[model samples]
Target: VTAISGSNVSLQISNLSTNYEQLTWLYSAHQKILEWEFNKTNLFKSKFKNRVSLSGNQALSIFNVQKEDSSTYILRVLKESGKEEEWHISLEVFDPVPQPNIEIQKKQEVNNICHLQLSCKIPDQSITYTWYGNSRALAAGPQSFMLEITVNSENHSTSYTCEVSNPVSSKNDTVYFTLPCQLGKKYSWGWEGGHRVDEVKKDVGIL
Candidate 1:
């Protein structure tokens, strides 16, 4: 079972028969969590006092799950015919994925083509990143957080999206780029008799 942190999770008991005499929930090896006998339920672990409960069908429900709650749980059932059955369940909890932030690492224009390098920022390394262009998936790999693209007059105003996801949650962010390759110009301004004057100094170069 996979669950997100600060969420609720339920571990259901499958193939349960209605003729069971007793039911017991154990944590790890021998740490008892709860026991059901003679139509009465008793909770054994103080740590799960107000955070754990059993449903009508003997399914275990945990509230406000945390990272420390990831472990193996066992359920033992005793039938009226003196037969015992055991089931082992493994639970894994993960933090929610945060919204991805895209940053431009480098941008330059050469021969009317804009070359750009973008990076996706996130603190967690155990997640996957996917890049999209104009709502279509890019050619980058699932683990690639860096993207390099070239923009020209045909695709100057293109939008890119970065999606970050884990086993339990996902988030995405988008960025748009407008590239206009033209000659760079410089301007000079001066004040003469309380009047502002402006003039173009010179053309720097193609940018």
Candidate 2:
């Protein structure tokens, strides 16, 4: 089974007969963590104390699990009939994903032209990304975090957010792009002193 780091996990141990006389819990790193013999409980001195307990059903519960807790757990049971049995389990733990980092690759307005490219950085591996524009879902489970945007006067004011998620957790980071409307060209012609006069002007440069 798999679980997120810093979360609680329960290792079920059941189906033991009343003849069970001894039991021991073993970890990959440490040998013996807890044991029971002669109808007595024995807890070894380890870093897992205060966070590990056994339930009435003999289920082992580990709290505040950490990355190092990912390992093999072996449970040995000895029956009063001079027989022994072992149960094994494998556990995987992962860290929660951090908030995504938003980077503006391109932001420039020249000659009334603007272009923008934003990047949503994935801080860790095994994570997925999603993009939202103006509170609307734009992309789902995007493999890449780079977003090439087409900024228009009406849509430039739109807001963009990137959500980074993983098996353990999800987080969102937002970015906004506002662009000015492009200016239009105007031309005028008049007659001055019986002479034809023409004037032309263009406006398009603003941030």
- The number of the candidate with the highest lDDT is 1
List all candidate RMSDs to the true structure: 13.3, 17.4
**Candidate 2's residue-wise lDDT over 133-154, tens digit each?**
7668777664768877566565
Which segments of model 1 are wrong by more than 4 Å? 139-142, 155-157, 180-207
Instruction: Report, for all candidates in order, the number of backbone clashes.
Output: 0, 1
TM-score of each: 0.76, 0.65
Give the C-alpha lDDT of model 1. Answer: 0.74
In order, candidate lDDTs are 0.74, 0.68
Q: Which segments of candidate 2 are over 4 A away from where they belong? A: 1-4, 14-18, 108-115, 133-143, 149-157, 177-207
Supply candidate 1's per-residue lDDT for 67: 76
Which candidate achieves the best TM-score against the true structure?
A: 1
Clashes of 2: 1
